[model samples]
Target chain A: MTVSKDDKWTEKKISRREMLKLTGVGMAGVAIGASGLGGVMKAMGYELLEDDSTTAQNKVNFYGPHQSGIVTPVQTHIYFASLNVLLTSKQELQELFKQWTPLVVRLMNGETMVEATTNTRVPTGDTGEAAGLDAANLSITVGIGPSLFDKLAMQHLKPTALQDLPHFPKDQLQQEWTGGDLCIQACADDPQVAFHAVRNLVRAASGKVEIKWSQAGFNSFPAKGGTPRNLFAFKDGTGNPTDVQELKKAVWVDNGWLKDGSYLVARKIQMHLETWDRTSLKDQEATFGRHRDSGAPLGKTQEFDAFDVEEKDSNGEYLMPDTSHTHLARKSGVQMLRRSYSYASGVMSNTGAHDAGLLFISFQKDPAQFIAVQNSLGRMDKLNEYITHRGSAVFACFPGVQKGSYLGEALFNAL
Target chain B: MKYKSLLSVLVAGGVLMAGCGDTEEAKKEDKPATEQAEPAKEVDLSAELAAYKQFALEQMDQFLMETEKFVNFVKAGDMEGAKATYAPARMYFERSEPIAESFGDLDPRIDGRLADIQEEGKGEEEWTGYHKLEHALWVENTTAGYEAVADQLLADAKELHALVQTVEVTPDLMITGAVDLLNEVSTSKITGEEEIYSHTDLYDFKANIEGAEKIFDILRTKLEEKDAALVTTLDEKFKAVDDLLAKHATADGGYVSYEALTEDDTKALAAAVNQLGEPLSQMGIILE
Candidate 1:
């Protein structure tokens, strides 16, 4: 609701105690007392001191720099999502939108919409010959999935609950569920920001909604100070291209463009709990392209250790197996930022009747860059079969996040 | 602000990570000597941009008309519609402004919208973040010139949607997906884990990608409408982008521009753009 160049928003640099305060999880803060806190602080490269208050209340986004992430983000979004139960009628939807009007007052700490005298300054110039950044805008879409309906059926003990869920032939299970098929898309400048917005939204919809997943979407690199558009765990995308073809030209029409600069990748990651658990400590490390215990390269225990492909075995072959998951990932290209996530869909029938698995999603500037690594994985990938894909969506990432705007809006605009 | 490369952002972030983590003790990691190395060369990214210049003028026309329309309503005291479109319009401009960042110095039309706005926070719901254009469309009713041109942008967006499936199952997607799934399980705070995710949530995402690829093949090689001239340029572009991708990709995974961006180098940019780019504001989105 407030916007100012002064950047008065207090940088929400959550400390160990703050995280503990937010998640209300373990004694992470308590155990890190004095020296412990100091040790943790040492690791983070920050002094325990911080200024909580702001000089002016005009800045909506926190301006302080963080230890990690791009200091000044090209793209920054903090989404706020709410999972509301589907109203059977359009009239109800309209009413909800109406409800949002009055609620902004409560949601924004009493800030009211005002026609201000001060004008927001903007860049005024010519749009040159090159393609503009299209990823400035973002959109929210809603859909009804069978699993959602099944969950609803389960809630109300609906007789046709089983039919609603994707995994339906179980006649007995079907009769005991309340079907549902409505979902919402809430977003903003960063996943962290989205969390705030979504939290408030869901809170407002408490009785009228049955909250589903409220995830921080996409693992991007820090486009803004919030979340990485390519949030590859273990810091992927240490290398990538800065420029590709201009947006105005066509790759197909353009006769002379570099094939090396762009990339495309697709992967299906299946979680391996049963098989992974069966493996010994060393075997587990081998399965993942990295050390399982330390999340490091195959030969090293330290996180973010430099990978040396030349290290060899007695046979003069590479010490790290060529077929190792890590090896394939390395071979394709380093332009990838691997931000990933996981899911567990209750328990399955002992016979594995369930089709539950991982939904793989990866983003790169060019699809071809990740294609080589993908080809290496084929069906023989170290972590295959254990994970299965179900729902998939792809978005051409726009340039980056812009201050005082939502993600991907510009691209959506021209469209 | 010109568009800086993602590599630049990541490289900049790496240097900033000298102090981080929740525990006070975790904030003090040893700063490596190499971490202090020189950054890449800065480029005039805006000079490389391609925006729809005509679209800006059209948007402005619409903005004026819509403003007049809303003002007329306001004059008549039609507060609801005026308020209804207000927030949406404001949010729309805010959201759409970032696209100009990529055009560091290239496009003048994009620069215009980024630079000036008569109103700060005003517009409709659906129009939020794209206020400039949406205002032009609703209030100004300026689509006389662009009603036809809009099909191009819409068609391209659809094409991007159709192309998501051109990618298939691979290690990168798997690694990325698995990581995301794990994060979901670990961080979910909905109070009832039982209700949030079904087995389909796990597998459906990959299934959707697989399905999208099938759709891509039809759009690219098999579509009857694909050879219809309008999309013919895709043939050359895809091949070029594909080739450039293979060359610049890394041995350990990451963007190729990583080196150039951190060191302020534009070698990768020039090489990639010259090798893989087209001059038409190429807006391709892929799903794999």
Candidate 2:
């Protein structure tokens, strides 16, 4: 991990672009040899950089039974954009998806969207901002919104449960950050890498799509990985399922073109910091039904202590208040894999409150799981007082790719 | 968070200085580096601060008068008048809320929401503020037990008026406050949730915009001298939002009912707020 800039192993591991530059190989030769280069180099016993703790340098596998970003370890940064499809015809939309697949693959492999072309008069194939950088563990997850079905005239193919979320009590949802025809969630260890992934994809879809709304979010990485905190300084995503089997039960969809996929529920919850900041510690703790410092459930000393909504104190009062966020969420018994992150655009210009909140993202096998939990929290959750659900949307995430197939290939084929 | 940021900056500066030391040492061994960039000019903000102080005081004076009127309406048991006057009265407070909020416990006492009190597990006796008056006027539909709270509100408004005269209106406050006003609208007011009980968020929204506009007005000359293009963009954006807001204006100049607004109207206003906010946020950095 501490390998110096001039290390021998670093020098030996020549990138494909570097290899082309050194050998003066033409584009055809490079393209033909692209898939086999790693295998060929391995067979020739050429030792490159060791597969170790270089998380930022390592390339994540884009093709799998399920998308990488869904259940993969949460990256430090994310640039999630929901784009409205400009193309009306199914053919054009499918073509855009087809064009995006190879680019997504190249980016995830830590390569530029396309190999650099020697045409000075024309624009470069790749944007070149990420030219000198690694892939930074980039993972791009594409999703289809409810409106996309109308555009493609594929309503029959839509998932049975794929629909807009119900408006909850106290929801002041803004339209701009609400819904879109399609969404791309890009996550990476480096912020620039995550942003670059979305930028290139959006650029590639120039005429076919436009950004409906986007939110950039981040999670601070402690030396040891653990749950991150929301803008309210409370540990969020602590209850998320980490086991693969548990994730499969709670997240992966089982039918249609979305098989092995998941449903993404994104909510832009604006935390009322001005009011929350004025709140007493006792009230704040009561609102959460957990200890702020340790993130432990009331009447428990550890963060992971099983939450008992019915537990009582010496005064015969409920230790975990029924209205507390944890109590209501726990009582609902609906499980989803939460992968939320905090975001702050800046201090809102209208009010002095910090324009910050959790970009609450959750994935489940069905949207009902998320809805059930939200419904449980709708009218009674004490945390509701300090937060507003300002944005809401649901997207049907596509299943992962096979070795040669591109993203959402099954959906394209079905259409 | 501020301490952490400062520490990080110091650490980064140390690293940069160390790198420069090494490079300069090498350069001295070869030849002295030529053509260093000129230092940036520093601008004085005393005049701006003085101007903002005057603006804050004037705003507070009007806010005091309005709060007294609201209190008087509540005392007279004029429920409809109180309801109608509620949001407009909040305008003065909203315009200079950042400065008002600068005084610990003042804003909460005067403009705190019902959730603020209820969340704290306090009963009506403990909940003392405009929101208390609001709940009484709207929810209870009577001002029976709010007499004491009314007097207290009037007293607090006067306190705010006196306290504002001595306020130090720094450039950072104006810059941050301007952006904060926009964020306030985007976060809660635009959603019509800011004045949820009364549905008078339109008034708060207008006042916040006016407050932000006032800051831009005071700093316009300075900002223009620095970045004329940004000032021009802000001017167009401000006009765009104001033009849209004008459609909702009543005969009395206050906004129409918050419930009267359509989703499209809110959307249009929010877009304009963002359009203005993006460039307005740059003012602070420029001033710095």
Candidate 3:
């Protein structure tokens, strides 16, 4: 499926009310309150509302109950940007989201941010780097950090469950990489597409926001296809909940303005490849408590075969070592969706060591689910010796946007 | 003394006899061996390499002394004193960076920045060096929490001083080290990423150029013997870079804060460095 240039030109003329009607969301559904409606309405002038392109290949629908990139099958590449808001008021923040709504929709539909203009004297509307690329199943997820509330004086609207992650043992968090007022998680099958989505969005919002820190990451799948291996060569994301019902229970927030929204916890974990490479295959397998080849539990044969962490051999020894990463994580008795990617930036200038690690991202209904599991693995997991947690952030990702409404409209309506 | 002179003359005659024997063998091959009649003298670079090692050791010694004095000011909670010493202290390290980087892990332990440590996925505790203290003194505006960092900076400086004596400086090292010094300036120092908080990047910038020039000076005679035009171009280019840097120099033999430079100033400096770097990169190939 492909969208021709002529189709995009006509779609730009579709009015907001017409767009809502086309998407089956009646006028009655939008309940933007009186207090912040003016700024949101002003932002409406800039909106380029259009239906998701059905003809576009590998496209994810923009309108949904929950955001894409969370439950959407993991993409091969990600370009995550943590930004600091330069705006002052809550109304301005709402306006910024409203402004971003249609731009994001256009990006997911595999179209440029706006129609091409013949005027060559000025800078182009969209950065043309992603011109020849498809949507590549691109997903853009935006979330507000805990600090954003205090900055905008909207602490009352902030979720009680949304806060920064507590420092765990062996955390070497650097301030430059740690906190941010907002974050953009752009993922796509093609890295250039993912990076282009972010680059264009950030450029569109130039002075209003600045990137505090960002890391680009990727995953390589086997030719036949399966779970991808991390830098340590162990299959990752094996324990993620696959059932829709389980995903809903584990991930989606159920109440308040944040209903259907989930918490995102991002950790910049630096894996010490030099140390891991020196260990024997047996010891390496013991570190993750999974076979390096098949990604199975120690006593299990298949990749997905489940086994009890407490189950012991005839010798009364636990099959999975009590100190293994998977064992402790399982012992926590909680789950979250792990959507992570590996990053190899280059060598560290001083030590000549590879500057590589996992950009560990997880989605959960509450941040506590992630916190509980991390606490369980605290200091005791053998994996701790080979990894260092260098950065951390938690953000309350908004629920998906319905037609005629903007991103985070629920928060503004509650205000 | 008379006996030693006689022994040296005997050794010189034996070397002459060996050369004649090689020339005779070449004649028997019946090829046009006119060039081999008097064997072309090999340019022995051993003396130059030894001279470069001595210069590097001197730079390391100065780095240690200045770093100790700077660390003392930091540990005493003297903010102004520490800030005053900071840029001057880093000058020595910047000058001797090639030799300092030769040792495994020592360079990073003593000179690593916050970003460097972050890249290694290590904690803030692992970050110990001049820049770490530079952050506390300049950005944070206090030296209260960096007591251990100050002590470690001194210890690492001492280790670097001890390590320099053991370096087996070679011709390749001298050639490459010159290029590396110029690269350090063009990449980080020009951008003001180094000395980010203090804005004293010009100090390090000048030092790197000086270090690279020292290498060129030692190899000047050998370089001229091969390519005299290249040697002349290098001399002029080096002077151009030095002249541009001289514009930013302060009365105290220090440089103006990197932040004080206008966009035009930086651009001109960058142009001069690039001009020098192109000709300087050829030194290795010419020598080989």
User: After TM-score superposition, what is the CA distance of residue A69 in candidate 3 from its true location, in Å?
Assistant: 0.6
lDDT of 2 at B258: 84
Give a tens-digit lDDT track for model 3, residues A1-415: 1112354543466754464354334222332221121212232344445668889999988899988899898889999999988678988788688778878988998998765633332235677899988999999999999999999988999898988899899999998789899999999999999999898787666446768899999999999989999999999999898898998889999999989989999999999999999999999999899999999999899889978999999999989999999999999999999999999999978889999999999999999999999999999999999999989999999998887678899999998
Fnat score for model 1:
0.00
Q: Candidate 1 lDDT, tens digit per residue, A1-415?
A: 1112233322445443474343234222221211210122222222222322233231222212111111122223423122435344433433343343222222222121111111111111111111122212222222233343343343232112112222211112222122234333333333433344344344433334555333343433433333222211233333222333422121111111111111111122334456555666665455555654346677676656788756786788765666566776666544453324333444556556432333333334444434445565555555443434333222222232222222223322432
Per-residue lDDT for A356-393 in model 2, tens only? 99899999999999999989988999999999988999
Q: Which lDDT values do the candidates have, in the order given? A: 0.32, 0.80, 0.84
Clash count list over all predictions = 224, 15, 0
lDDT of 3 at B149: 88
User: Once all C-alphas are superposed, what RMSD does model 3 give against the true structure?
Assistant: 21.3
Per model, kept true contacts as a fraction are 0.00, 0.00, 0.00
Shift of residue B68 alpha carbon in model 3, Å: 46
Candidate 2 CAPRI grade:
incorrect
Candidate 3 deviant stretches above 4 angstroms: A1-44, B1-256, B259-288
The deviation in Å at residue A61 for candidate 3 is 1.4
Please compute DockQ, using alpha carbons, for every candidate against the native two-chain complex: 0.01, 0.01, 0.01
Tens digits of per-residue lDDT, candidate 1, B1-288, equal 345687788878876664444344443335455654645433222211212222223333443344445444434445455544433322222222222223332222221232232233423221212223333454554433433223333333233223322323332232233233223222321111211211111121222222222223333422222122213543443344345434544464322332223211323223222222221111111111
TM-score of chain B of each: 0.20, 0.83, 0.84
Report the lDDT tens digits of candidate 2 across residue range B45-72.
8887788788888888888888888899
